[model samples]
Target: MDCHNYITVFPERKRGQHLGREERGAIQQLNKQGYSLRAIAREINCSPSTIMYELRRGTPLRKSHRGRTPEYSAKRGLAVYEMNRMKCKRPHYITHCSDFVKWVVAQVRAKKWSLDACVGHARLHQLFADKEMVCTKTLYNEMAAGNLPLSLFELPEILKRKQNKKGTRKHKRLKGRSIDERPDIVDLRTEFGHWEADTVIGRKKGREAAVLTLIERVTNNYLAIRIPGKNSESVMAAMKELHAEYGERFSSVFKTITTDNGSEFEEFSKIEAWGSSVYYAHPYSSWERPVNERHNGFLRQYIPKGVSIEKYTYEDILHFADELNSRPRKRLAYQTPEELFDAFLDKLYIA
Candidate 1:
């Protein structure tokens, strides 16, 4: 180690400790002896940058005394270290945004909104200035550090994330046409009217009510209609009602829809004659329709499994879908699904 750059010496270095007075003195001595920064660090079992920073931080000006040569002083280094020690404490500003925090907590608890959604939406709307609001990570860190009133588990998605289960690889029957034949434009989601459909059931044994959901691929517009049961008839009835509601515009609005191989959607392929196209996903492949599956997870926050959806009225289902559609999505550049969907409609009809 003392050979000092004449040879490269590899040694086990001290890790993650602050600079000490002894290290500073060693730096001064080695530097005075014409040793390079790397050589000094190798001899003292530390990093070259540590030596370089310490030299920069503590080296004093000697422009008058040495005509521009400034020497490293151990006494000066220790004094600088003491000065940096005083600045070690950073003020905790998590409490500064109390109002914003309350609004975020309320939205999470009442609306089942995600933290990132709440933060991003607020920022996009200018609800709070830079100093008045904390980032999503900072809010999570506040919960982690116990500086906040709530725990991470109190959030809707946090606990459910760990509980996500793999679906059965059971036989999934293919109906009508395959999604493989569907246009690539549906996947790109740039144009409107393409949708992914799914059925959410309640109380596997005794429940008769289910939610027939359709999310627009482009605008992320979510539609959840309460069906009579988890069967082909119920799904078909709901689709007919949706067809009747939009009338002439129905075909244009729902240009194409992608569905899973659930028994409930077995007769769903009948919509092919109704002008809008219907396509089926592959067996046991939920990833093929990612946006639909993700929104289903969000719906689980309201209509949890093993509970009866029969108890909730159709109006209640509409309200739940409305809330979800109104919430801003990060993928949509912080725009709400309802907003984007309406804009698309205006473009299609008015333009």
Candidate 2:
């Protein structure tokens, strides 16, 4: 369904609201467009008083030449700078109560409380006051400054932020296909024939056998196939089964398949023979295959470590996959994979 966008004006009650410079510019444009004060108020969703004040004082007409000097040259800029400086000048209660600070840092490390939450909790218990409550940013700064030992905060696990490394060369030989070689259409998932694939292995062998996962990158709709083994034949069989059940609709959606450098995905040519392009991720680079890895995580909730995939009937696996596929995701704004899949089909028809 198609919908038109419209803006609604705010009520007159919010009297103390301030308009920024861009808003003042908009008021100037709408006023010159000959919109009535009430009409402009309704259009901007501000009160008539707001519009009147904005028209008279918020925005002054640009003069042909420079006129009277302003009384306040450094308005908000000076205020913000001074406020930050004042905050910096405040004494550290952390230094006085090093024990309490260490405890708070430990709580943060355990994810028991966010910095703001800890500060609020501390204030409630009289552990700290408004003056002593440290801001989240300030706490992070203090941690980075080495004034406090991060080890006390379990810094290795707690404060660690991992980002994908760049400028790294592929570990495997170039004889194997690379993700960069995949077509642009595959990246877009325009017709749905493109798939992002990943293999899920477990820490415990018997509890979780490897599973091959595929996700439609665009819609984030996904499917998982439990593979008894990590061999090329096993991988090929799973791909073939997925294709057989989904048929042409599956064929229509899965134009290309991309996987990581794991040897299990060595059956790329066989998969490509079924009319799909196959690409491989850089070795040790899971971030490039984020969507498929996410589905694997979901599967792990059911078949975690120490469980063998051989124990799960294909039916059991499919049922679990269906449950996952049917559940609504917040990234899709609570739309189920089924709904999004249907929407994609509708879009395909419209096109």
Candidate 3:
């Protein structure tokens, strides 16, 4: 009969689709029955050249009475196709950037650096060539795919948070001036001396150790001091030490400080008499001092919640604060807070 009859028996193959095992088997059976290459191509909805190539690849030497003869095997064609596909896959960047990947893992484990910070710091310093490093998104993807050594828990501030209802609650009493009275310059974060203050407590029990935290609005320079307890007396004592440390430059360095109406900061307004303005946020409003709250979260990475802060020495607390200050921030153009803060101090003293 006619070769066109075979086309009706087999379903038409889509253009550019690779030949499957079933199609290959059909090619062998048709070719055995003396079907022309062009006729077989029409049957499978492929080109004549594709049939010719498949025949060459699928045909192998077969032993017979008249020496070795070539015969097409569907199994042979599929094996060769799979081998070629494996060889044609795109190479992963991890192989070429092995050194950079290793360094990233080390920093995340040893220094507790965020993946984005690691990538940004490396790019800012030109620590590696363009071909030798992947983007931060790729790094996180590799971690998710289990290609990296680090785990999700090791990353700071990467956990999901429960959504809470947002509303402003009125406080029974105001400890000091309200944040409403704070100057607009403080909100803009363009000035250098405006700061946000807060306290991190270890446990809810009586007389637990706490940490006093302060962060500059502009440079995000962080200062953390371990104190005896979360009380106004302890908070003022830390402030006194800071005032003494800054000495003549205290007023200029700490122009304004915004804090919450916590009992720990009840006596904090006294700093105004020492030359700096103190503004108090509304009750249950932590967002008013976001920078300090965020840095306190970073501090939690080293000193976890519910654990006594007294377990860590004063030097350990200082080291944690220093590490935070030395970390590169994307908002700071990949520069460390310490670098920008020191530069600002230099300019202030020279003026």
Among all candidates shown, the one with the greatest lDDT: 3
Against the true structure, candidate 2 reaches a TM-score of 0.49
lDDT of 3 by residue, 143-202 (tens): 778888777898855675745646868745888888999999898889899999999988
Better of 2 and 3 by lDDT: 3
lDDT of 2: 0.65
- Stretches off by above 4 angstroms in model 3 are 1-73, 160-165, 171-173
Instruction: Give per-residue lDDT, candidate 1, residue 3.
Output: 66
Shift in Å, residue 76, candidate 1: 16
> Could you tally the backbone clashes for each prediction?
0, 14, 0
In model 2, state the lDDT of residue 127: 69
TM-score of 1: 0.76
Q: Write the per-residue lDDT of candidate 2 for residues 132-184, one digit (tens) a residue.
A: 46655677677666766554334332443667667646656633678778777
- lDDT, model 1: 0.86
- Count backbone overlaps in model 2: 14
Residue-by-residue lDDT tens digits, candidate 1, 259-293: 99888888887887879999998878888888999
Worst 10 contiguous positions by lDDT, candidate 2 = 69-78
- Backbone clashes, candidate 1: 0
In Å, residue 104's CA in model 3 sits off its true spot by: 2.4
1 against 3, candidate with superior lDDT = 3
